[model samples]
Each structure stands twice: as structure tokens, then as C-alpha cells.
Target: MLRDLAGAEWPRRAGLAALAAALGAENIRWVGGAVRDGLLGVAAHDVDCATTLRPEDVIAACKRAGLRTAPTGIEHGTVTVILKDGPVEVTTLRRDVATDGRRATIAFASDWSEDAARRDFTINALYAHPETLAIADYFGGLDDLREGRVRFIGDARQRIAEDHLRILRYYRFQTRFGAALDEAAETACADLAHTLKGLSRERIAAELLALLALPDPHPTIARMRERGVLGVILPEACPAQVAALARLIAAESAQGFAPDPIRRLAALLPPSPDVAETVAARLRLSKAQRTRLVNAAERTAHDSANAKALAYRLTPPLAIDRLLLEGADARGLDRWAVPQFPLKGGAIVARGVTAGPSVARLLQAVEARWVGEGFPQGERIEALLAEELAKRPQP
Candidate 1:
């Protein structure tokens, strides 16, 4: 009985109305996450539309309406309609002509059911007319969504064989929406777990992080471990690390810190910087991501360091990561702006220290003392500089 997209604010947006009028409302229907999340009464962030119009025609129609359009994925039959509210992805209806687990060969179609059949999950196949807001459930998606079930649209094995990343996507959806795992879907994912090796590491990393980013993913992660799916993409994560993730989640809750996928990822690895670096490289994490993962894995005695000192030594965010992982207090640094050291290298050189390596060493010593002494300023900085200068040999 899913009749209308009641809570979905996107359809009411003026830009969407303009786009619909320009393209003829009958040709387009809101599809995918927008429809699914709208049914669940959750606010949808991205609005995707499936249309009978071809890509070039979509571009032409938008231009005729004086609306900006981008060929964001024109080859894949998608056109981006840039509205003032946000960019809406308008994709022509497509059916997969062929799939090889890595990529798909698609063919444009006029049938909505054909397009829905090509999707991975039943809940994702729901569509809604833009004007009337009537929902179209092609594969019992509304029922499955109401029942809190995450099931593939067709045969789970056949759907997963088309895209190995769906295995990870299944677990991610199950973690977020399912009250109980669909036994058949679970079995299919487990049986085809080895196929994940054929997919790109970047794809694997993206899915893994998305799963970790869930509100409470440790239980699902433990499930992933039991199926041996986690080992294929992330061999560094051991069974023991699942418990560590649970602990990290609890710490994050207790400390009122937001759930961080990268930090949670750090919890799933052995507390070794070398292992973190290896995992980061294997997953193709960005440079900043690699650094954060490695820093979180460092086996430092975070409990011993005061909040300010830790923040000064290893940055506020990284320090917060270490403190939370160790189950220590991180509230002291909350909204506390880290003060800069008052002394500079030039200031040290002005104190008769040579402008070479000695000045650098003197600056480091003073900075350390300043950090150790709680980042004192004004006259206290002058005193620290004098003490460091006294230790240095007179030129």
C-alpha cells in the first residue's frame, strides 16, 4: 500500500518541478534511493530519476528549458540536471546487456520493469511518479522494505555474479536495514566471496568503509568475518579485531564522538603502524587517509599524555583517535583551540644562537618545553628560550 512519497522533500523542490515540466512529467519517475528512503520516511539526500528520454534528448530538453545540464555519465545514459537546490541525476532507463563482475554492458530501454530488473536489490527498484507521487513496486520492494529485509531483486547468485561488489553492498544494507539476515542472500554472498578478489581494491575499500560508517557495524562485521568475506578484501582484520571494533564503538558513544570509518578501520587492524601502512596501500587509501590510519595504529601510551600535550604532539583529531581507541578521556580537547608555540627559529637565532642547525635544535627544545609546560605564553616563553640558550654552547 505504498501510495505516495509523503516525506520526500525533493519532489516538492521548485527545480525538480521545473525539470519535470521541461522534460514532460510523464517521461520521468523518481527512482532508487529517493523512492526507497521516502517510503521509509527518511530524508533523501540525492534524488535520482529514471526517464524514457535518451541522454541526448535529456540534454536538449534541459537546454530548451534554459536549465543547466552536464554529461556526467552520458555514455552510461545519465545526464545531470543542475538545479538551484542540487544536481539531480536523470538517467535513461537501462537494462544490462551483459555483466562480467567488474563492469556491465548496458542497453537503453523503454520498459520500466526491464530497468528495475537490472537493479541489485528489491528495495532499490521502487519507483515513484513525479507529479502524482504514486509508487511503482516492480519486485515486492515495498513489502520487503516494510519487513526490514534486504533481498536481491532476482536470484541472489545471479545478481551477485553480475557485480561482485554487491556482496559487500548486501552486507552493508543488511547492517543498516535488516532485522534478520536473509539466509539465501547470506549463503550466496558467502559462496561467491572469492570473486571479490577479481574486483578493484578501490571498489573494495569504498564498500568496506561505507559498511564501517554505519551507526553500529561491528555485529555485521563479525558476520562478515564468519562468512570469510572480510578476509578476501581485508586480510589484516582478524576475528579478535571485531571485538576491538565493538569496544571502539562503545568508546565513541561514551566520548560522544562521531562514528568515523577510518578510525574504526584502524581498530580492525593490529596495533602496528607497518600493518596499517600495508593495509592502506592495499586498499588504495588517499595520502591523508593513510597517515590517519597509520597514526591511529601507532602503539603509543596515549593514556600517559595529557590532552593538550597529545593534541600538540599528534594533532587534535589524531590525538582524539588515539585517546578514544585507548578508552581515555578526550573531552578536554573538545572545542579547545590548540595554542601555537610562542617562539620561532628566527627568535632563537636572535638570542646569539647561529642561524644554522643549532637554531633548529634550540627551537625544538624550546617548543618541547613549552608543550610540556602547558603552552605558556608572554614572559614564560622568554624564560624557556633563555634556558635553552644557556644549554647551547656560546658562539
Candidate 2:
């Protein structure tokens, strides 16, 4: 299946330009999702090339072309060629020599069929020649991709057993393709769900985050729960809460916020202390994102007495918190964060004629005085500051 690149023209140019220089007589072919997506008439961005060249040869070729090449995964026969516009990942054909489920020892091979067979799923095994506009489907991946079926390439159990992380990936693929999985594939995943303990929390978190970040997460998680995957990964997600969160998420999915990772994660959190931190640590999220997400969850769980306390509880997302309060029977966002502290630390320092802790105390006194006065004019603040400043020691 070939057509002139029309809509997303830049990425098409990037792929073509990179392949033109790198694939120059090397017989390298575009492989994996890039090809599958192209075949499905979907615009693809991350273009990967399967090459006949060995890792060393790819390195040498890039050097010969004066291209910057990094050993992205040298042991796994992958090198990222840094081109002027786009980076193309050139990976030699490889098949697993032995797999311990967590890691595998692979050997580079020239047999495209052998390499394709060792891949995880049928749809991911398809390859295409960008220049000639030809496709190579050794395992009937074309048919499977077209049918929206996510089936393992050869043996389902054997494939997943090669890497336990694939167990989570199956549901992610289900979310993307919405493909009806084969019976044998479902059985294989269900059987291996218990073996997920062998996988590291870091790996589990990555796959789970990707699944939750999908446009529609409920179907994917529901599949995982049904297939016994979620129990092993996230049992704290109350079944009813999970469904409600998903429903709220889908309804709010259209607007109100960017697709920020922390926002998405806040929507997923259960009413439990340390769970957010544990999951965030497990996923290896950046310190900022983790803290923000934890704060969001904690704020959502709180029953603050007043507007100020509630506003303090929810640092940001004033609008979203308002909606959440309505949904959760809490004080409205306005009533919660209604009052404003007009005095600044600098103003307090200036008024007190002293720095350090005294400035803080003076500001606090000013705030209290302002609130006590029910928020008066500049005359009231000036009068209050004058009274508080007299109590501070002159510096």
C-alpha cells in the first residue's frame, strides 16, 4: 500500500531524507509501528529502520557519512543516527538467542523473517521499503493489522515469557488498536499475570503509565483487571472508584487542561496515603511531577474546614478543584480560596525596619489585622503595620 505523502508532510520528508542517505544501497527497510501505521493510513512519527548491516557496520557507515551516531543500545544492535533534521534509529535484524523473561541475549542476523518472528506481536512485525514502496509481511502481519487483532507472532506464551513486561503491553496495544485479542493470546496473558512479580516496579510503572495515558483508559484497564493483570500491578484502585475516575476522566478528557502527566496521574489516584509516592517512585517520575501529583491527590482527599484551608490544600487547578469539590461534596473552589493576603514579606520588612523572622511575624500580624478589619483600605493596613512594627526590635 503506497500513496503520495500529503497531510503530515514534514515527518514524511524527515523519514525519506534520513532513509535516502542511510539506506543508500544498504538494503535497510522501515520496520515496526512506523510501517504498520502507514499501512493503516495513520500518520507516523518515530520511524525505525531494520538493516542488514551489523552494529559496527552501521556505526562505520554513519561515520563515513559524517553523521553523528550514538550507540543507543549497542548491545541490542541499535544506533541512533543524528541527522540535521531528524534522528533515525538504525537497528540490525536480531533474534533472541536466549531469554530469561526480564532480559534477553540477542544475535544480529540477516534473515528478515527470523528477526520478524522473534518480535512480540504480529502487527509490529511488518516491514516496509520506503523507497520502493514495498512491504514485507512474513507472519501475515498485514492481515492482522488490518483486522485490528493483537496476536503474538509465533507462540503467545513463549513471546510474553520472553519478557514479562509484554504482559502489560498487550492491554496497551488493546487500548490503541481496540483489537479483539485472540483466545489463545488472552489465555497466555492470564496464565502469566502471576509471573509479573518477576518484573521490576520501574518496568511495570512505565507500561502502566502509558496505558493510563491513553485517550480511553477504561477499556484497557478493564481488560487488564479481567485478565488478572491489575491485581498484580495496582490492587489499591477501588473497583468502583476506578470506574468513576475513568468516567470522569472521559467526560473531562475533551478540555479544561492540557494532557499533563501529573494531571492524568491525579485522576488515577485512590484515596490512600503514600500510594501516589510509591507509584510515582516506582515509575521513576521526575521529582517535580511526583510532588505535584502527590499534592493533587492529597488535596482531592482532604475535607478542609474553610476556603483558605482548601485553597492551601490544592496549590493549582483552581477551576478543576472547583469542579472536583462539586463532584465530591466539598466546599466550592471560590469559597475555599476566597480570601487574599494583601501584605508581602518585603512590605513587612520595610514596615518593621527589621529583617528575618520579625518580618514574617509582622506580615502575619498585618494579615490577621487585615482580616480582623474585614479588609480595610490602605489606611487600615498602614495603621496595622505601624502597630505591629513597634513590637519588633530595631535592626
Candidate 3:
């Protein structure tokens, strides 16, 4: 049995206290990730609360308390209360009325245990009171949390049948917190891996990126492959690419770079821009994300000799991606800011070159020479320009 939330700082926020006072502190308790992470001693980023009060009543209470509230998910029994510090989600305790693996129809309930029962995982169903800071573990969530286990509540397959996204969530949680995979949950996820096809590509992409964003996702990713879940959503990422991902991770660590999900995703795919664009389209990635993915997929030698020139051509980030993918040193660009081309087309025209297509052609030639010569400036740029112009026929 978990005791009070001692080291948790979220319960002491003024906005939470004010809202609690307005809605009778006993009527509300911090629930879900906030409660789970608090007990784990991790700083909770978002605070979620469950209340006996209905959505409308919660909105009314917030308005009366002078706190702004938004109907973020009113149909599903949630209201966003904007506090001074940040927004805290306040939701009425709910029970699943119906579920179709994609979404659920929920009904308001006053029983905390009933609400906890409807949740997906035991660790996520834990709650903590506001006033006394007492934890309510309707399931063995406290024991599971202490054991670093992520088990689904009740029937694993049935819970997954309620929401197919849980399959990915299980892997993410397992990667983040679990010491060992729950055998039943793993089996259920493997069996229901095909159901992930029914989920929206956007949702699947979000979950996949979140999983890839973890510091060390190699083990979980291998487990996902073993369970046949990775192939369902990301068929482009072949088994051989798992080794590529491991190499990329090692390179990132060596370069003191943070874990980049998009770059990692690029590493998992073949070095073909066409394949990258196709996968990006299938996953519904944003335009910028798609471009980055394609850029990283381009088959190019990221030689250390031309590191600056590469950064100059394709921005530093893209250049770094290619360098890291090829296992080349990219630290030369750590503090180096790409310099602007010292001469423009106007400068070429000023040198008595015609202002038509010839001027543009001459500028390109000079810039190429400048880039090849390591972006020389001052007299060197003037010398390059004079040399290029001397080659051109006098007007």
C-alpha cells in the first residue's frame, strides 16, 4: 500500500489549492500519470485530476473560483482548468459504456474504483488525494510500480480490444519503466498487433515517435520486433535496420547529441529518398518532417573533409544527420556557424559582367570556387571573382 505523496510538489500549487477549495478538496484527487510519476519521484509535467463533480459542475466551479476553464473534452467528461502556473486537466470519474477499439463512449461515475477499473494499466490507475495526500490503489498499482511492472488491468486482451493503441503504449511503458516484460501483456500485444492497422496513421505515428524518442529504445524495439508489432506499423524498417538503429544510437552518444526520433527513424529505413517519402506519406508526417526524413535518406558520402561545405549546402542539421548516419566525425560543426556567400549577383554585375543569365552563371561559378576553397573571404573572394571574370569575354 502506497502512503501519502510526500515529495510531490504539484499538490501544493496555489491554483490546485484554489480549485480544490472551490470544489471541496475531498471531492478531487490527482489521478493517472501525475500520481504514478509523483510516487516514482519523477517530476510530473501535466497534472490530471479526477472529481466526483460532473463536467458542467466542474466548469461552473472553476468559473466561480475565477479560474478560466476550457471544454477541452467535455463530451468525454473533461474540462481544462487554466491555472496561473499551467493548465491542469480536471475530468469527471468515468466508466466505459461502450468501446470499439478506436474510441470509447464513457459515462460519468462517482465511484473512484469504477473509474480506476476502466483505465488501461494498473500503474496508471493510481490516485492521490489532495488534502491528506493519501494514495488510493484500487489495483495492486503500488506493488506494480515498486516492482517496475506494467500490467494491464483485468483481461489483457479485453483491455487491448477496447483501445488498440495500448499495444504501443505497453511497449513504451515497458521501455521506460519495466524491469521485465509482462508475459501476458506481451502475448496479447503480439496477438493483437494487426489491430493497430485500424488506428489512424497520425495516432500510430505519434506513438511510434514517442517510443523512438526514448533514451535507449533498442531493447524494447527488439522486443517489439520479436512480438511482430514493429512490422505491422513500420514495414519499411526491416530487421537488418535494427543494427543500423543501434549504430546510430552509439554515434549519437559519442557525439554528445540527444536522441532524435526523426533521425533514428531515418536510420531504420533504406538510404533511398523515394522510400523515405513513401513511408512519410503513409505515416502522414508533417511537411517539414517529411523533408527531413527524405534529406536524411539521400545516399551521399558525408566526408569529414567537406563537413563545412556540406553544412553550407544543406543546413547543419541535415548535414549532421548524414554525417552521423555514415559514422563520420561531425564535431567540427559544433561551434561553426555557416558563413554567408561574400559576393552576390550584384557584385558580379559591378565587375562589368552583363546583368543577364551570364551574371547568374558567373556568380554560381565564383560561389562554387569559394565553397571549394573553404569559403575564403576578403582578398581571396576578390581574387576568385577576378579570376572568374577574367575568363569571361569582355562586354
Candidate 4:
């Protein structure tokens, strides 16, 4: 499975050469998500190296090789080796000393299996040789990967007890790569969903964003709802809106729309500004994210006479978001083609109108007439503007 990954890239080689020379080649191996992604033919974003050497040993090797090093997590036996492209994280093998469902105290260990066992899931426990790419799987992650199963490393309850964040991670991995969750894992997550409140808002928000970004997350969301996890994370979550999300996904697919987490979140929430505001505040969303969600909800509520009116009143993104939420296609967004009002303040001034509120009022009146008349162009627009101004009582 790792044959294609054997020919290490320069970054991989550089990291390995620096470390293998200082700590024996037998002590270092590529570990964590990189191994799993490599076997799945997914481009590993960050290359992580695990070693039997202590954190200081890893740092010394990086310094001896003339590479920059940082103690990113030295207390947990991890160091960052800065390479040309990016820093690769290297962690010494460690066994858990204690866990409190949020953090784990660790003690460095020489046994690779102990480190592997301490991990959360079987697939994430797999390791690879930095030079030869030989897989070291002590947990049958290879079989799970082949079968598209997401299983915990050992006891599901024990893994969840180590870190409640894993509850979200389990669903995320299932949505991203795996087909389904093991029954025991599902039961454990459902029973422990309440613990998610103990997690930081940032962590919970990040996981939710990842889950919502999946190509099609309606089923995953439904599963989350069934497991009681969704309500725990988002008290205002509307599982009933999964149907709306399905329409959104279909519309996006047909029209080549990029997956948008904020927009999808709007669809998942009750289409009310109050609900949007509450979710935004609960998730601690950025100002921009909050504004977009709220605007989409507000804009989608108005009964636009047509797509043109909708686009002209709001923005294309807002209109499209609203359309999808209503189970309607955003077909004309790319071709919104809403011509300008064809009347500006200067034009109103040229009409012998004062530059005060009257000028603004007259211009707005003419623009409304033009829009009401279906955005007539050229001479007709000029004629219509003249008629509207003449009908206004002299001031």
C-alpha cells in the first residue's frame, strides 16, 4: 500500500536524514494522519515523524543537521523541524500518564505499540518507515481502511473519556473518509455527547465547519442528530432542515458552487435572524461570518418579485444563499446581469433639482419606476424618469 510513497520527496528526505543520523534509523518512523492519508493516496498536508528519541534528542538532531527547530510541544515530546516548505512535527513515543476528557498528561516511552495504543483510532495509529515506507500497524488499521470502517483504537468509551473532542472527530472522519461508524463507537458518542459542552467553542466550531464542508453532509448530520451529538453542540440545530441542506447540496453540484460552511449553517438553522444571531453568538463566529448568516436569513425572507429584484436588492451571494435555502436553484447568479439604475445623483442635479433630500427622493422614485417597469433601457428610461418627476408635487 505504501509502495508509491516509498520514493520520499525532498522535504521527507531532509527530515529523515537530519534525524536518522542523530538518532538511529530504527528509532524514527513517519506516523499519524500522514501514514493513513498516504495509504489512501491522499496528499498528506503535514508530515509527522515519531521517534523513540526524547524531545531533546530530536531537537539536538535537528540542530546538528543545521536545521531550525522549535519546541512546539516539548513537554509532550514533540518538536517542529523547519524545512524549506514547512515545518514537520516530530514527537517522541509517549504513553498516557492521565486523562481528564479534555487533556492528557504524557510520559515518553520507548515502546511503539504503547504509543499506538494510546492513540484514539486504529486508522490514526498506523505508522510508516521514513526511508522504506514500510507500514507498522499494530491495530489492524489496514483492514479497517480497506473496509471503510471507522473504529476506535481499543475501547470506544475509554478513547472518548481521554478527549471528548474525539466525539466530533469520529463523525468528521466518517464524513470525510469512512463509510460508517462502529456500533460501539456510535453508542459511546451518543452517551457522551453532553461532554461536548466542556470543549472550547473554537474546537467545536472547527469540527462543525469541517463536517459541514463535506461534499454531502446531510446523512452525516442526520446521523449526528440520531446520536444526540448535534443538539449537544448546537442547541438550536434543526435536524429537520437536512432536507433543505440536501437541496442546497444538489443546487451547488449542478451549478458548480463551492461548498460554503456559513451558508450551509444558515440552512441548518431556523431561517430566522434571531436563530442566526443565537447560533453566531454561541459559535463565536467571526463578524463576517455572523453578518453573512444573518443577512442570508433576512434576505431570504423577503418575497422578491423576481430573481432580478432579489439580486438588485441584495447581493448575488446573498440571493443565491437564500434561493438554495428555499429549495430553489440559483441559476442566474453567474449571469445576474442587473444593469445599473441608469440614474445617478449627478443626473438628478442636472434636472434642475436641488442637491438636498429632494434630489435623493426624485432619483429613488425614478429608479423604483424603472425597476418596476422591468428595467427598461435607453430612451424609455429617460422618458419614464421625466414622467415620474413631473408627477411629484412642486416643493
Candidate 5:
């Protein structure tokens, strides 16, 4: 019984309105994330609806309404209807007919209750009538949402059996919503933790990154490690690093730093190139991400590297990642304050040097000294540049 949903305003959006008009107000309702977020007063990023109409019927209805439709996942009974405002995804009500702990073979169903029953979490199984704005809670999702509880709908073990990725998702949602874990859910997750191996690296990586994106996700991650769920997929993961991550996260919040999942992930692993590479391969991370992770590991391992020099060499983002991973005080790592090298190739050439490898070598030597002297300026930099020129062998 949700009241006054005008604050959500999503149901009034042109896309949803057109979708509702085409599918009939009673036959379609906002479902899944949109509905859950709406009831919680959080702005939803995507609007997904569940409808009694089948996929073909949905496409035809959208066409009749003069809305462009895309078969985003037609086999799965999902259509992306593009309206004046945005695209609203409408999925026909579905029930899992078979499952193998990783993938589910779903069959379209007309019964809302049957559709709700197949969902993983109660808090996510909510539905909202488009026009009336009345919420449909097939399970006790309303109570769970109000109480900050994350529970598997119906049976915990059965849900886990249906999809092992829910183990990671359980922690992710817990952290996101600030909800306490359901005891049965936790127990089921721990008992069936090995099933996570059957899941693809991409799924695990996506879920893990989402978990790390939450504010102060360290506590939940620590709990996952304790339950041996982290090790099930990332055997090389070091639980000890999460302690460092906790301190870094505190500093990040205090200094108004945005959340960084890659850096946070670095804090959870050992600082080894081989390990970083292996993890990247396992997770199928993009090339740029893999390079940054490996570079952070290598740079942080250099105990003698000055933080400023590191920032200059590895670029500020990579250097900061390294600094945080190695337990450097975030207060001291003012990367933006790192001074730029006062000399360039042109500066060296202006000092009576020809434009060749000789100029390049001279600039490299001077810049090395500048960085070595903590990026000196004025008289100090001039003196160093002069001395290097004198030693240039009169080219």
C-alpha cells in the first residue's frame, strides 16, 4: 500500500505512459528495479515493466502506438520501447521452468504471483500499477524494505540453487541498501559457496565490481571472505588487504573522493604482477584496466619511490592507486599538488642545443635531476640546467 508516488515521477514519463497506454493499464505494471526504487523514493535509472502480453504482442502494441521498438532480448520476452522521453524495457511475466544453478530456462507466465515467485530477492520482486500507483508485494518485500532486511524469497537454498551468482548479489544488495543479511540466506550461501565456481568470470566480475561500488562495502566484503565465498572464485584474494581498504575508504570519504572500484579491487589482492594479470584474465578485464592494475601493483611494491615522483611517472590516477594499496597515508598523497617538471625538450634546445637525440638526452638528464630534486624551480632549476649544459661535451 504505497501512497503518494508522485515523487517518483517515473510512471508519468512519456515512455512509461506510452507503454502503459499500449499494453493497457491493468495488464502492465512497472516491475523490478524501477518499482523497487520508486517505492523507496530513490530515482530509478532504468524503467522496466512486466506485462501479461507476450513478446510479439508487445512489439505490435508499441508499433500501433507509433513507438519504436527494439528486440533487446526477444528470446527472453523483453522489448525496448523507445518513446519521446526514453526507452522502457517491458518483459513478459516469466517463470523458471528449469535451472542448473547457473542458468535458468524460463517460460512466459501470465500469473503475476508465479512471476514474483521466480525472482531471487524479495526486495526486488515488487511491482507497481502504472496508473493506480498501487504496489503489489507478492512476498513480504515491503516489510523487508522497511526493516532493512535482505532475504531470499520463499526458500534460500532453493534460490541459491536456481542461480549461484545470488551469493555475490546477496552481499551486493546488503551493502547497497544497508540491510542486514538474512541468516538463512547467509547459511545457504556458505553451504553452497562452491557453486560460484560454475559461474562465468564475467558474472563474478560484474557482481564484485557492483559490490565494491557501494559506500563502505569493506565490511560486507570482509564478511564474504570470512564465509569463504570470495575464495571460491578469487582464490588469490587476500582478506588482509581489506583492512587497508577500510582505512583508504575512510580517507576517500573524508576528502570527498569518488568511489573507484579498480583501486578498491587492487587493495583486496596481493601486489604481484603475475597475480594481477591472472585476475585480469579470469575476470576478462579490459586492456586499460588490466594495465592500470598491474602498474599499480608494480609501482606500490617499490618502497623507495617517492609519492610525487610516482605520480609524475605513473600518472596521478595510477600513482594514487598504488599509494593507497601500499598503505600510504591518503592525507599525504596530494597528487594534484605534485609539481610538473620545469624543463622540456624545447627548453633544452633553446639553451644552444641542436634538435637531435642529443637534445633529447640532455632534456632527459635535466628532467631526471629536476624530479630528483623534488621539481625545483627558479635559481635551483636554472643552476641544474646550466650544469648539465656545461657537461654536454660542447655538441
Candidate 6:
């Protein structure tokens, strides 16, 4: 039971206890990730609460209870309250009045069934009565949870039509549930994948990142590919990425590792950093994430081209991403010495070379000569440079 769910986290429990004391059984429990994780024996990350109180009332009561409150998603009747113990997000029950596959216009609904019906998945529709621990499943979410099944809260197609992002979420839960996916859910996803065109690029990016961030992204992505969403979003990849991902997963399995989503995303890329960066931009990855993945992809491409070149081209984090990419590809990557590119723009500029493309070309030539000389001593570098400069035609 998740709706108004209490976590095993002691601070969370204390907050729930205080909430029950403050509301005196008026709280309808919560219905989100916390309950799902608790049921799965996984640690909960975020907790959400559902209540009979309107958003304003939730804000006021939170103030009375001495918790800081903020409008995080008030447009959708959600408010975030800062408990001395931890932050809690509470939202009022609501029913979707209309949806055009990108966004929903909702109306406040006092009935739990109406709220439950509006939920995207059955596993999300269950609720617990804080006082009784009595789980409510107007949509058989508990049964689905037990069956390791991910089912839509109502008609699968209707639920997906409410939010195109739910198409991605349906597959995300595939890795979470470890269950046989419901056929109806898959069909709905296929039916609604085209509707994702209506969704904002930023929203699509966040959803995609979240999906990629999951511990087991490959399987879910495989499902997405099977459903045609993958090709539409990323035409670069084939099943090779999945094979590479499996090797990465197998090698890391015993480490009990937590993954870096950005690096993992690079492993999913084709040989092109341009393509990866473009996809990152389309999803509106934070500038930092976009930069990180782009760098990671670049390092991977270079390392794939030449193991020795990688050390010269990439720094530590990017090098790590590069090796991981190779490992994911089931390619061997042994370390090699990487000589520095030994030419400086300032030094080249001081050599009677003006600051323009010529200087850049001179630097490239110097570096190429240094590499060609088997990375010889400084005098050897000077000799080659002098020889090249003397042979150059006047520009």
C-alpha cells in the first residue's frame, strides 16, 4: 500500500506519526514510489502523500505543524513540505477532466476511486489507510504488485493518452517489476508512441534520462525498441548496444554497483558523438549532463579508434567512460602510454606565426611530427620543427 505510504525510514515514520496526529485520520495515505519500493524490498527514494486537505489547506496545516511549505507542483495540486526530519510532498486527490496525450487538465475529486482511476498504473493506484494499514485497491494494484505485473489503472489506451511519457514509464516499470509485461500495456505504448511528438522536448528528455538512469536500462530499452519508440528517438543504435550493455552489467554485477547514467548513456550510443550530443540536447539534459555524455562519447570514439590515442585525447573521467564503452562493446582495451600533443598555441604564435588558421595548422603539424618521431627527445622535436618550418612555403 503506497498512497500515503509510510517508509521504514525512522524519520519518515516519525513524520507520518506526526501527520496522523495533526490530521486525525483525515489523510488518505500516499500513493507513489515509496510504497512500490517497500513492496519490492528496495530502498525508497521519494515519498508522496495523498490527503483530503486541499492544497492551500495542506500548506496551512504544514505551517501549523511547523514545516516549511513550497509550491512545487501546485498547478496539479501538489505541495512540498519541509519536515525537520525530511521533505515531504503532499498532493490532493484529483481526477483528469481532459487530456490530449501531452498534458492533463484535472479537476479536484474527493472520491478516492476517481483519483485512483486517473493514475497511470494499477500499482500506483493502491492506498493505505494510515490508521488501519488497510490497503485499498480500487484498481487491483496490490494484485498486480504481487503478480509482478505492471498494468494500467484503467483502460490502457486511455491512461497512455493522458500522458505520452507514460509510454516510457510503462517500460521503466518492466525492469522494476521483473514481471511479464501486460500485453495491453505494450499495445497502448505502441499506439501512443506517436503522441510523444506532442510532448515538450524538455519533458521528453527528463523522462528519457530517468529511464536511462535505471539500474537495468537495457531491458527496458529493448522493450522500447520492440515497440518502435527507440528507432524514432535514436536511430543510431542497434541490438549491439544491448549486447555491450549486458557485458558491462555482468562485469559489474558482483560489485553491487550504482551506475552513472551519463556514462551508461554513452555506452548506448553509436560511434558518433555528434549523434549522442544531439540526442542529449533533444532531451534537454542539464548542461552538465549533456557536456558529460558528449565528452564521454567523444572519449569512447577516440579510444575505439586507437587505445594509445585515448590517453592523449581524454582525461580521467572521460577515459573511464571510454573503457566502459569498450567493455560494453565486448572489445578488449588494454592501457597504453599516451604522449602529450607537445605543441602550444602561445609558443606557435611567438614563432613569427600570426594568430589565425595557419597557427593552428602549424601546431597540428608539430604535433603530428612529434607523434611520427616516436615521441623523441626535445632536441629531436626542435630538429623536426626546424626542418618543417624551413620547408614551408611563404603564406
Superposed on all Cα atoms, model 5 deviates from the true structure by an RMSD in Å of 2.8
Best by lDDT: 1
The TM-score of candidate 1 is 0.93
Looking at candidate 4, the ten consecutive residues that score lowest on lDDT are 2-11
Instruction: Give the per-residue lDDT digits (tens) of candidate 6, residues 16-86.
Output: 66766665565657566777666656677566788877898887776787767899999999988776567
Please list the residue runs of candidate 3 whose C-alpha ends up more than 4 Å from where it truly belongs after superposition: 1-4, 332-335, 393-395
Q: Mind giving the per-residue lDDT tens digits that candidate 1 earns over 220-301?
A: 9998888998888888889888888999899999878889999999999989999999999999999999999999998466
Ranking by TM-score: 3, 1, 5, 4, 2, 6
Best by TM-score: 3
Candidate 4: pairs in clash: none
Q: How does each model score on lDDT?
A: 0.89, 0.70, 0.89, 0.81, 0.82, 0.71
Tell me each candidate's TM-score.
Answer: 0.93, 0.80, 0.96, 0.89, 0.91, 0.77
* Model 4: per-residue Cα lDDT over 276-372, one tens digit each: 9988888899998998899877854444446666767777777777776766667767667768887788877888877999888888888887877
lDDT-wise, the better of 1 and 2 is 1
**Deviating ranges (above 4 Å) for candidate 2:** 1-11, 14-19, 259-261, 264-268, 300-314, 317-342, 345-362, 365-395
Candidate 1 residue pairs in backbone clash: none
Task: Flag regions of model 6 displaced more than 4 Å.
Answer: 1-7, 10-12, 251-257, 299-313, 328-395
Task: Give Cα distance to truth, residue 105, candidate 4, Å.
Answer: 1.1
| Steric clash pairs (candidate 3) | none
Deviation of model 6 at 368, angstroms = 13
Candidate 6 RMSD to the correct structure: 5.6
Q: Which residue pairs clash in candidate 6? A: 2-30, 3-29, 3-30, 3-31, 4-29, 4-30, 4-31, 5-30, 205-283, 244-328
